[model samples]
Target: MVTALIVLYFISAITNSKKIVILSGVVFSFLLYPETFFIICAISLLVKILSTYVIIKDLYIALTVLVLILLKNTFFSTASGYQLVGVSFALFQVCYYIKDNISCGDLISKLSFFPQLYCGPIVKPSSFDRLKKINIKSLALYHLIFAIGLFFKIYVAYVTHKIFLEDNSLLNSVFWLAYMYSDYLSWSLMGIGIAGLAGFKMPMSFRAPFFCRNVSQFYSRWNITVFKWCNDFFKVSGSKKYRKYKAYINIIVSVSVLSLWHGLTFNFLSFGIFNITYFLIQNKIKKYRKILLISQILFYFLVGYTFNGIIPNYIFPTISYKYGILFIVSLVTLFLFDFFFYRKVKKIISISPPLVIAVSLIFVTISFFVRHIDGQFYYAQF
Candidate 1:
């Protein structure tokens, strides 16, 4: 009986094109019952359709709904509930983007069952639409690519969890941070590669990001799509009069938004704060290119060592800080090594099909193992 009412409420919300009403219903249901997130997501789809023709106007409304949901969860719900609220808001953002006249074909082309659900490398509607019109032969080739991608997503990310992660500790925390970098790198590569194989041209998350000599370059190489999106939508370009300050502003806003999107956890906020400080410092000394490079390397190292393995859990026992230090250290070390020694990494891989396959396999193995242990889709919680 409760399920039916929830369904009917969503239907009513969408039919009326009233996001506030829909969000209100969702909040009430979640607060009282906590089993309505799924139903809320279903209703969100309907809202997606209803707003298609009036996207510019509705986007703000949708954002408002998300804010309300987050507020309600933060103030009244459990930690799990807060996470769920974050996920719901993330989904709503996607829905709003889709409602902005994104083609069905583009939507299909961008679909990656796992990544699309959780933390995403958020695709632009324009790019998604363009990819949808590819011919069948290309799509067939893409399917083969997608299969390989799926393997990495499942196997590589999953299997490597134990190798890179450990319980909360200073050393373990650093390791986990480093592990997360690699894990995210592998998962993102697989997700984007699969999308590409499906005949969609997607922006990459890491394009030799670790080798970048400075924060600005780091942003360009890491999560390219997210950076581009912020550039476009947030108008993060430096103004002629405020050119010096622009980079700092852009970095702060972009990192903050990215952190929030990860989930409204304290750890996520800390991560963003740390990144923003790093970027700000890096940007100030950018003119001294060599110094900038060295600083970035040191920054990565510190972040890796400090944030990696599972220190957060120990530091704040109420929170899960698995693999905190180790993860951070690994990423920093990898970045430093790649920048200083493996400059030709991209060039070599770009030309080697066999090498690509092997790397893809490794990533798949890690993803599969991680998923098995975590018992949750990494991106699904987005």
Candidate 2:
């Protein structure tokens, strides 16, 4: 099977066989399907040209090309299953590559790298170069990580399926917010796992987000690579050019674009504006930083609730005893586990490889029994 071959490609790096045949097979998997390959190539070419124009400092040409790509992305949606597959990530990579003046060969290689094309932390040009070598000693650890990542994805899928099946209630909403942390965590672990076996010391896509003390900290901790990309865009967009309103403009544009990058929907737009306003207020009240952390926890919960669409009722109209108790227990447990126990848990896992692998296998086994159907990540649609 092609899947097995790809796995072997990573594992075989210990012998440094060059894996030319395996690499070709992996690339061909993307190309074998005519429709998928066509769409990927078309979008890749458009973004490549868009970046080229930007590098030449031809704003008018770049804007024109960008608009055309947007029209293709927005209007002619059928070609890409209406989801536009890798455009969001590929566009980000285009920006990074152009800014760094990467050559055509390198640009194509980076964009077409199959491992991260589906979902990504948006690898930077410098980081992408790590693909050139193999780290044989870490192979066993990488296998453990991949298993853990598999368990995480399966567990999240199972939990979310059950939670959403419940009747519309405030308690379910609270649970959903706490569970949302798993999104980036699962994807990051998978990416890191594959990167490890491939011999690349990839950067983490997330840090301890739930323990974050404020809105600023949350953004920095969650989806770190994308956050940095947006920050880079903001710095160039107007922050450096306009001294007086540097912070104000950067926050406004960055948040808006960040929301837009997620999707072209009212809910996402509102999510962005809500966070922007919250960040501004927190910034204004910097002296009360301690309170902001507590406030941020509540603010993030509301954002998670609003993230999809309007709820059935405005804030738990009349909570049932069962749901209310569940919410309280779940919220308190989440705070304690993520905030207080995280370090200790990491220490335990680090010192005991057998324990780590055993626990991961147990979770993976549990996942097989409770697995349920689910769609791709919300950001995957973008």
Candidate 3:
């Protein structure tokens, strides 16, 4: 699949034809996941038919979410060993196209841009309009970006994952959350790089979320595209008077639906429950920014149990002194990486030709040495 994407990118780059790039990319993705065709096509058609209705906005949003949930229960629940990557992202794009009312000739092509198909920065249709104006450039910088993501996934996250397996201690809990972020950000950066190579600019999924002053701000930066869609689904997609309801109403619905939409498993249920509680508690502590920020980070760390509990054995596992020192080092590395990423320090350094070449060689060498761990990337299963 990666080979095919590289081929598609270079062909488009050589021909200087983005239309062919976007449309043909969709065809390639369909070959990889044909089940997506019916759902995406159905949503596209529905959005086209319903686009003219103005007063039915609330009902329209409700209908779309209900349709997706129904699809989840009927089709997805019954499938065995099926890889349903990109389903939610594709759904989000069509629904956003409906709500935002953007015009695009090939909805599937816009939704399934190959780089972002599995994991996403979830760009809007309006951005596709700018493709023609973007000066085509080599992907040297983007390759370095991809290497950083690969480093996060294979080295940092994989190293940290083994430690917190069944232990749910508060400290290990936070470390597990760090590992999750490392795992998630790995492919997110990779997708962004690949999308850039494909001549599409995907937005960053996070914006210094870990260093924020509070959980509300933390959430304001994290998985922003999904949250925006969820917010509009519950809040902005309604009439003006309906929009005047309490702000938390949208927060509650947005996270709940997002939670279940992610999965029907206990992992997702707890994910939804934890986030809902986390957001609701935000109101009580708004007055204390610094203290609240610290509290929020700790609370988010506790999500280690919610999102990744193997079993309810809340005992703290003993770590050897060496592993303990290594865990602390990993935590510091995670903090510095997030900080550097937000500040674009890494971006500046990655742009050096020598560094890019060095990263490429190291990436190839690591690729040769490591067993294929792509299957273990957290979101690949989704």
Candidate 4:
């Protein structure tokens, strides 16, 4: 499949960019691995056929591809197959978007490749392309930084998983949460490294996302690139005419797309609904000024635990009415609380050298101890 794509890319690059060659390349790849490539080709073909018949925009095509991929994975594939399809679709989407020049979708599709494909600090294409033009020295330095980030993701998260994930004790939950945090941080750092290596300017996604005072702020900082993309391409931007309502719509669409992108599993949908509800409530609180600081902690714990539980169960039964109900309930509760309360601001502490060393040592020690038990890094699969 990779070889076919490379050949096709070379042909397309040198030739007059005929659609036939492009389509043929895709077909060749599909034929090489029917189980995986077929679906990818079918979706791309659908987009191409649809684009010819209907004047549907590129963004819609991109969305369609994502939706179809999710559905295919959710309904058809085994666990490994599902990941393979999901990652393949993601990669294909990026490549197609880059070649087609389909407005913001094109740029975003390219930007979504590295960091976004993995743990996702999804970026916009324009910004990404700009970075790609940077000098070689900067790129090398960025790769080094990314390597360090990869070490933590592989080591620290692995250790935490071994210590807690396999044991299934109460402490396991705490360790799991800690592991998740580390996972997010490690991935984000890796993203920064990639962006730097690619020479793309760092968008405002990672500057203090962890220390955000509120859920909304946290999301804004955590994956500013995705947030920006959704706003630009998904047409969910804020406006005075319907700023509040628009914010809610953006939250829903963005979260839903995120869920679907994870592959069309019930757990992914649940996670999406969970986050949407959380964000909706967070937005409502902005108007009411009613923040529940403690609830923030509770919300994260509840959602995380529920998601963890649902994922294993979801693998066996991709669709479950009970899971759906639970998902809706979780979402509803998040909005209800968000509408009714205010949360206290937590103080940020300065990172002393000793504290940093301690944290690093703990992470390294834990990672080394439990490296064997860790599954493939989620992004690495992509």
Candidate 5:
């Protein structure tokens, strides 16, 4: 990965041709994801054809994208594992391309940009518009960002995942929540960092979700980009009638699509039901605000972690002092680290270059020594 980044960086510097840079992106994407890339190209071609002759372009494109999502979820995972790499994100981008009425060239670039495409911030057509390539000045900062992501996944999420493998636990539910957030956030931040190095400022995916008051708020903070995409795609501004019921329809549509986007399983469908049901319950009660607040926190975690089977009788078993301390650190790292550093990213990195360098090196060293997991990113499968 490091070698590829360096080569791409130098190649970008050496080439005066935009075509060369885009060609490299194509190769990088196809190399990691041959099967998915083929599908993306096919979709791009379809979008081009759709743009040419379709009279009702927007409606047809929307229907077509939803069908593409359904087909992708049904067929690809069964046929081949590698084909699933970035199908969800690429399909969504295809949706945006058609809606935004961009060229096939733009759609191809968005789909084949491996960093964001792999595990995405799900960028739009203007994501790379008017942007210059190569920002040597921000290279250190991007490196630190990537290192933080590595630490989040390879070290923090890895350590927290031990809670699952073993029975020992101070808080099974808590650590499971930590594990999910860290694992996903790590990929997100790494995507941001690499995308930055590749010269595009990506939107954030996680933003200190612990402060959220409800499941809706939690997800808005947790996967802000996808949440935003859901909202954007479903928005209705047609007539006053469409606008009047927009919020309710948006919530239902976003929640349902977000759930099933992970794949249409009993668990995911149930997750959507659970979310909407909980929303109704929250609306019914206006008092005991503290209790509802706490309940909302528990509700988010329970549905997220325990939806695979019947809910167990959780007793919150205790763990050894060693694991207990690690658990606490994982929570703090996943929840609070962004709150302190991310909002003020430029200021934090600018405070002391040496400190930033030290932190990046520390994470890199720890990643080298950490026992590696043998699987793709937990979110990538969906």
Candidate 6:
């Protein structure tokens, strides 16, 4: 698939055949997964019809309902596995394309872009408009970005597998949540990295989420492109009488929408609700920010357990003292890395390419030793 896309990219670059490139690319994606393609086409057609026939404001509301139905069925597993996997992102892209009335060439390129085909940072059509230009300049930098992201993903997979193998306990749960966050971070980075290599300016999907001191900040930093899309598409502007509560209402509505975008299962639904409740509580007691932050971390740990359906026997299992200490140290270290070095890590790699390569190779080697048959990313299925 990668090879085919590379050939297509170069062909387009050399000949500048925009329509043919986009059409052929779309055809290739359809051929690769006909089932998913058909589903995407259905939703795309629905969105297109509504957008063309209805008023802009009404279309937004109707489109939201249409998408909600599709999500509830597919994401909640009411649809078959073949119908569900890979539909979430494709649905979002197609809707964006139809609403924006994007050019044929750009629409095709945005949807069929292989780097984010399976999962995405959920780029809006407007966002991809500026990325229409393609070039092969500075290819080495792209490779480095891809390598670093892939290394992080593989390493997280390795550690996650190891965590599951250990005894189930609060310590393991903490590590598990850490792994889950890292897994998501890695996935976003990988998408950005690969898209960059292809000369497509993928949107920023993550920032210093770990460093965020509040729930609102956390959501804004995490899965950044998704939030950006939500802000645009799901902007909840209440009437004058309800203006003071607009922020809270927007927070809940937006997060609920984004959470459903994650998946329509109860687990994801609860995750959104939990955050909403916490956000409200924090607003009422602004002085307890530190306590709220600590609580937020624990809430995430509970989410991991709830999402995975693997409850520990006790809140604090009677595990070895050494292992318990190890878990705390590991969790703190992971958080610290992201908090302090989130921005610097990328800069370090750009400045010291050889060192980055060496470290990536080492991480890959370690991954081989610790590897287990990990499943696709939690979000990738969507």
Report the number of the highest-lDDT candidate. 5
- Which lDDT tens digits does candidate 4 get at residues 57-130? 65765676566656655655456554442343343344244335354423323422334343455443444444
Assess every candidate by TM-score.
0.60, 0.72, 0.77, 0.57, 0.83, 0.74
lDDT by residue (298-358, candidate 3, tens digit) is: 7875766776544545556576677777677877887887777557745565457565646
**Superior by TM-score: candidate 2 or candidate 6:** 6
Candidate 1's residue-wise lDDT over 49-155, tens digit each?
66564545443554454465445444534445545423443344454355565454333223322333234565555443335454433433333343343443344
Q: Which ranges of candidate 1 are over 4 A from the true structure?
A: 1-99, 102-115, 129-160, 167-174, 236-239, 304-379
lDDT of the candidates, in the order given: 0.48, 0.56, 0.64, 0.48, 0.67, 0.59
Q: Alpha-carbon error at 69 in model 4, in Å? A: 3.4
What would the TM-score be for candidate 6 when compared with the true structure?
0.74
- lDDT measured at residue 198 in model 2 versus the true structure, 0 to 100: 58
TM-score sort, best first: 5, 3, 6, 2, 1, 4
Give the winner by TM-score: 2 or 4. 2
Error of 2 at 42 (Å): 3.1
Per-residue C-alpha lDDT of model 5 across residues 31-92, encoded as one tens digit per residue: 86688788788878887886677655454555566666666665665335534677778877
Tell me the lDDT of candidate 1: 0.48
- Candidate 1 clashes: the total is 70
**TM-score, predicted candidate 1 vs. hidden true structure:** 0.60
- Model 2 gets an lDDT of 0.56
Evaluated at residue 294, the lDDT of candidate 6 is 81
